[model samples]
Target: MTQAQNPFNVVFVLFDNVTQLNFTGPAQFLCRMPGAKVHVAAASLDPVMTDVGFGIMPTVTFEDCPQSDLLCVPGGLGVAPALSDIQLIDFVGQQASDAQWITSVCTGAFILGQAGLLQGRRATTHWGFTSLLPMVGAVHEDARTVFDGNIVTAGGVTSGIDFALTIVAHLHGEDVARSLQLNFEYDPAPPFAGGTPATSPQHIVQAMQSRFYDDRAAEMEKALRG
Candidate 1:
């Protein structure tokens, strides 16, 4: 027989253009928690097109999202588009006001930053957004995961799995987290050995980065203005 260390209700907020891998990785870990429940929330109840063009049917809308013990925000290309929605930004900000833990993956930290939730909180996000995050009052931790008291932020998309395991440990104790980890048998072998800008070949990294933001650069300028 085992004991439940803590009981939790989790709310996962998804938006259009969100990266599916970013959401799915953490979700897989969260759903495995014993006696835990999750609510999938969106700006609207309608299906959202992910950054990769996959669609997800949201189970709840911001208007109807259940109050949660934990609020999770996921990041992707959608962030640039979603931040334009003041209500959604406000929703995440307010939700974190009462949540026991404010968690984010990848560029999801951008949402928390816009909501002003990450101010003074040590956090991390996708490598590309690291510099901008600190400008918003974050500590700019460069790690696969950063746990600053109640705020937990993970770097990049694949980092979601590591962050979730950390969360499970915090809530249910290391024993439970270890058990879950053993159950999942995670043995990842990423083909790309590079993670951060400093470690990767500068030429390849710069080229890849240029391709990503080539279009967004103008949009980013506009976003800053309006």
Candidate 2:
């Protein structure tokens, strides 16, 4: 795509249980990426409620989502149904068939994997699910973010901002990304003791898995069966 002629069309696919921060983070960060244009695309026309209770009105449907230059799947509990929905999976699977750069935040990687796009690709997801990546045929990489081929996957939720910065660096230039990072004062401040499994105590991790991630885990397993 030519620079002047091509509008860098970006679509972030959202669904129920999607992490609001994943979309909001990158949307805010990359809103400044030169010619980058963004839209919220979803499986349905209805306003999809996120896991955190935020409602995102999708601007386009999968069938209607414009030919995207950059396509992102932002992770959440939505990844559960998205992986299982053949239509949604087929829609995203087509993205890999085409040449558009595909990216996912957190467990969105699981959706992409269900579409059979991540087979043998080096990808990363919410570090909590790192061990789970191999089951879907991804080469698990332990990183805050990982870039392999056309796929760029970010760790957990907040990392989506950094992932967008990286894309800005790749799409525009490193200077632009760095500038935005500085503009945002992109530094870490964690209110909690654990951001990742390694940082969280074993008991805490187990508690999280049992209490928080249990339903989502079951949903994923059901999707994998299909």
Candidate 3:
């Protein structure tokens, strides 16, 4: 077998206004792991809205969430509000305490930072929030995926796919990861080279910042300060 048949429990924290791809990408890979049980958990088993205007039904509640070998937290606009959510924060803290692998994607790293899990650790998040990591006691690294010990963090939305494969390789094997990559047809050849700020035109970057980052940074700053 490419992967060992050991039982594995993986839990993903679901919240309102989450970026669907952040969780979905990683989940797509993790769900295929042999003997792996994946759970989408929230404070309660209710439907949660996404930033992109869709709803997802959490499969389990925090109260019944099993001890996870891997715990994933995804990020979006909702993360600002969640900073003040003691229940959510507490749950993340508790889960991270025992999870063999603590991971996050995009702004999800901020949530983990607020949970006090990123203190003095090298981590990364969506490019927009790179500078903000220091406020939460994390040293930001600009990379697609950053792994420090048992804590792994991914860059913006799409990076979750790479992050998951990294974890899969860690737990399973390199062969298993390559097989899954092929199964998912993970090849990427974007029509445009504007995904990152460095490659994008200045006007495009400014436009995106004006539309999404400005207000988000302000609200997030306020939430973290409070």
Candidate 4:
């Protein structure tokens, strides 16, 4: 179907304990894409629990989801267990077969990787797990968003917004994307200059890695191996 005539079916694969912002941030922007139809598909129609101590209701079951124009996976603490869910991995692989864009935010890249979609692709994810990309046959690209052909991977949670805006610009035009940015008042002025490892104080980065990411990365590595 022609772009003007086609409806953009954007599907987000949801799972229990997902980081809500990883999905919600992008969904908020992508939902505004002209003719966009957003579907939150999960293993069942039940509400999927998120890391924020709440749940997001799925709009459709995996069995009922439509062929997607864009397929996205969002990640959180649940990713380790999700890596072993055959049904979820299968759904991602199946949807990607026909999707115009296959994407992920944060450690959702691992889900894509588990589906064998990231093989030989340049990808990125949450900084903590970047080193593990090679385990899934993906080459790590140190960027907020990495596009390797039709596969787009975004780093961490908030980066999903940038990913969404980039996709909008690709499918629509700069004018439309720019308008969306303006509409959302997308200016970012963080209270601190420590968003990334390079920008953060050395002590802060070392502490975070030692206290959190070090173990988190090890857990992810174990999951990927399994």
Residue pairs clashing in model 2 are none
Looking at candidate 3, the ten consecutive residues that score lowest on lDDT are: 1-10
Per-residue alpha-carbon lDDT of model 3 for 1-226, expressed as tens digits? 4966666989999899999999999999999987789999998887989989989999999999988899999999899999999999999999999999999999999999999999999999988888899989999888999999999999999999999999889888999999999999999999999888998999999998899898888888889999
In the range 19-56, model 1's lDDT, one tens digit per residue, is: 99889888889988876788889878789899888799
Worst 10 residues of 1 by lDDT: 216-225
Superposition error at 222 for model 3 (Å): 0.7
For residues 42-76, what per-residue lDDT tens digits would candidate 4 score against the true structure?
99999999998999999999999999999999999
lDDT by residue (128-196, candidate 2, tens digit) is 677778778999988988999889999999999989998898888899899999998988777887788
Mark the regions of model 4 whose C-alpha exceeds 4 Å error after superposition. 1-4
Model 1 error, position 28 (Å): 0.6
- Using lDDT as the measure, the top candidate is 4
Alpha carbon deviation, residue 111, candidate 1 (Å):
0.6
TM-score of each: 0.90, 0.90, 0.96, 0.97
Candidate 4 local distance difference test against the native = 0.96
Query: CA lDDT of 85 in candidate 1?
Result: 86
What is the clash count for each candidate, in the order shown?
Answer: 0, 0, 0, 0
